[model samples]
Target: MDWVFLSELAINGALTGLLYSLFAIGLVLIYKASSVPNLAQGGLTMVGAYVVLALSHDAGLPLWLAIPLAAVIMFGLGFGIERVALRRLAGRPVIMILMLTLGLDIFLRGTTLAIWGGTSRSIELGVSYEPLFLGDLFISRIHLVGAGVAVALFVAFMLFFRTRTGIKLRAIADDYMASWSVGISVEHGVGLSWALASVVAVATGVIWGEIQGVDQALSLLLLKGLTVAVLGGLDSILGAIVAGIILGVIENVGAEFLDPLVGGGSRELIVAAVLILTVMIRPHGLFGRHDIERV
Candidate 1:
C-alpha cells in the first residue's frame, strides 16, 4: 500500500465510476418512469456496441457517424419494445412485468448473437493522443474523454428535465392517472422515457467499447450497471450517477489495493456485498423514496 499507488487507484476508480453512472442513470430513468426495471438494459447496451462495431469497423463508416446511427437504431428499438412488448402488459403484477423484461432480455441477447455471431470487436477513433502525466500517475486521454462525456450528458439531462416534457414525464412517474387527467399521454411519456433510456444505453456502449473491446459479453458487464442502479436508489437519477461513481471508485481501489491480500475477483464480491447490505438496511436504496403501502 504505497500512498502513490493508493492515489492512482482512486483516480482509476473515479473514471470507472463515471462510466458506471452512464449505464446506471439510464436504468434509473426507465425504472422511475415505468416503475419496472428493464432487464433488457444490458442487452440493449451490447446491441449498441455491436451496432457501432458493425457500422464503423466492418462497414467502414466513420466513428462519429456510426455512433449516432447506433443511437437512432437503439431509440427505435426502445420505442418498439414499449409499443409492442411493455404496452401490452401495463397494469400487470410486478412479478409478471419483471418476467416480461427477463423474456425481453433473452430475446435481445439471442438477436444480438444471431446477427453479431458472438465475435469480439474493437473501434479505433483514429485520434492520436498522449497520456496526461501527473508525477507518478498517468491518466489516459480516452478515460478523460469518457469522463467528460459522461458528466456533460448528466448535466444536459438535468437541464432537459426542467423542460415541459420533462415535467410531464416526472408527473407520469409520480402518478399515471393524474398525468392522464391533465392531458399527458402516459403511453407517450413511457415511450419517450424508453427512447431516452436507449440513447443513454448507446452512449454507455460507446464508452465501454472504447475502454474494452465490443463483444457479446458486453451485456454481462452490465451487471455492474445494474448493481450501481440498485445501490444508488432505483428511482433517483442523480443517485444513480453518484452511486455509480462511488461504486466505480470503490471497485477500482479495492481491486488495486485489496486484491493481493484477499485474492483477485473479490472486487465483484465487494460490490455484491455492498448491494445486499444497502438493500437490507435501506430497502428503497440510498436515494430512493420509501414505499408506503396503504390499505
Candidate 2:
C-alpha cells in the first residue's frame, strides 16, 4: 500500500462523497416536509440529466442554459407529481403513500426509457480546466466546482430553513393539524417541498452526469441515494448529507483497498453491511427522532 495511492484514494472518496451528499439532501428534504419517502427522486434525476443532454446536444444550447432549463422542467414535474399522485393521498396510510410513490417511480422510469430510448449520453460542458496536483494526489477542476456547488446549495438550504416559509414547513412536519390551525396551507408547503427537492435532483443529476454520463439506467442508480437517506436518517437534512459523504468514502475505500481481497464488487457489499449495521444500531437513523407511544 503506497502512501501516494492512499492519498489519491482519499481525494477520490471526498469527491464522490460530495456528490452523494447532494443526492441525499434532496431525499431528506422531501421526507422532512411531506413525510413520504420519494422513491422517484432518482427517476427525476435521470430525467434532469437527459433533459440537459437533449438541450445541449440535440438543441445546441449551451451547458449553462441547458442546466437551468432542465431544472425548471424537473420542478414542474415534481409539482405535477405532487398534485396528481400525492395530493389525493393526504391522510391515507403510510403504506398506501409509499406504494403510490413506487408506482410513480415505475411510471417515471418507463417515461424516461420511452423518451431517451435506453441510450447513454454525455454532457460536454466545455469546462476546459486542469486538475490541482498535490504531491501524490490530483483533484479535477470540475469536481472542485461540483463540490463548491454542493456546499453552496447546502448552505443555502440551511439559511432557507430560518425563513418564515421554512418555519411553516417545519411546523407542518411537526404537526400538520397544528400548522393548519395556524393558517398554513399544508398542501402548498408540501408542493413547495417537492419543487425544492426537484431542484436538488436536477443539480445532483448534472454533477453526477458529468462524472458518469447520462443513461436510461440512471434511474436504477437511485438505490444508492435511497441507501444514503435511510442510513442518514430520513428526515434530517444534515444527517443525510453527512451519511452520504460517509457512504461515498466507504464505498471508494472499499473498492480501493478491499476489492482485491473480496474478489471485486465489495463496495456494494460494504454499503449493504453498513446499512444493516446502522439500522440495527439506530433504527430511526442517525438524526431521526424516535417515536414514543402513549398507553
Candidate 3:
C-alpha cells in the first residue's frame, strides 16, 4: 500500500468532487424553488458549453468575454423555458413536469447538434493542465482552480439567497400555495431559479469543456450530477457540496482498488451504486428535510 499513491487519489478526488458539486447546485436551486429536479440540466450545460465555444472560437471573441456572454444567453434560455414551457403547467402533476424537462433535454440536444454539427471541440482556458507536485503527491492544476472557482461561486450564491429577493424564493420553496396566498410572486421566483440554473450551467460547461471536449457527450454529465444531487438532496445546496466530496473520494478510491479486480471502468458504475444505496437508505439525503403532511 503506497501512502503517496493513496493520498494523490484522495486529494484529486476531493477536487473533482467540488466540480461535481457545481454540477448539482443548479439542480438544487431549481428543485428548491420549483420542486422540479430539472432533467434538462445536462442539456443546458452542454448547450452552454457550445455557446461559449461558438463565441470564443468561432466568433473570435476572447475567452473571458465569451464566457459571460454565453452565461447571459443561457440565463435567457432558462428563463424562457420556465416562462414559456413550464409556467402554464405550474400546478400540474410532478410527473408531467419531469416529462416536459425530458422533452426539453431532447430538444436542446438536437438543437445543439444541428448548430454545432456534433464536432468535439476544446475551449482553451489558457490554464495549464499540468500536474502540480506536492512532495510525493500530485494534483491537477485545472481541478484545483476549477474547485476554487466553484467554492467561491457557491459561497456568493449562498449569500445572495440571504437577501430579501432570495427570501421570497425560499418562501415559495417552503410553501408554494401559501406564498402565493401571501402575495409573493411564485412565477418570478421560479423563473429566477431557472435563470440562475442556466447561469450555473455555463460555469459547469466551461470547466467540464476544458476537462472533456465540448460535444453532445457533455450531456452525459447529467447522470453524474444527478447522482450527486440525489445523494446530497434535491433541495439541499449544502448537501450537494458534502455529497460531492464523499462521492468523489469514494469513487476515486473504489475505482483505484476495484478496477483491477473488475477489469476496469468501475468509476462510472460507482455513481449508480451510490445513488441506489442512497435512495434505499436515506431517501431525503443527508441534509435534506423530511416533509410531513397531516391529511
Q: Which candidate is the best by lDDT?
A: 3
Please provide TM-scores, in order, for all candidate models, with all chains considered together: 0.93, 0.93, 0.97
In angstroms, the error of model 1 at 81 is: 0.8
Give lDDT per model, in order: 0.82, 0.80, 0.90
Root-mean-square deviation of candidate 3 = 1.2
Report the C-alpha lDDT of model 3 over 148-241, residue by residue, as the tens digit: 8778878977898899988888888788899989999888889999999999999999999999989999998899899999999888888888
Q: What TM-score does prediction 2 earn? A: 0.93
How high a TM-score does candidate 3 get? 0.97
Per-prediction tally of clashes: 0, 0, 0
Q: How good is model 1 by TM-score?
A: 0.93
Candidate number achieving the greatest TM-score relative to the actual structure: 3
**Rank ordering of all candidates by lDDT, starting from the highest:** 3, 1, 2
What does the lDDT read for residue 134 in candidate 3? 94
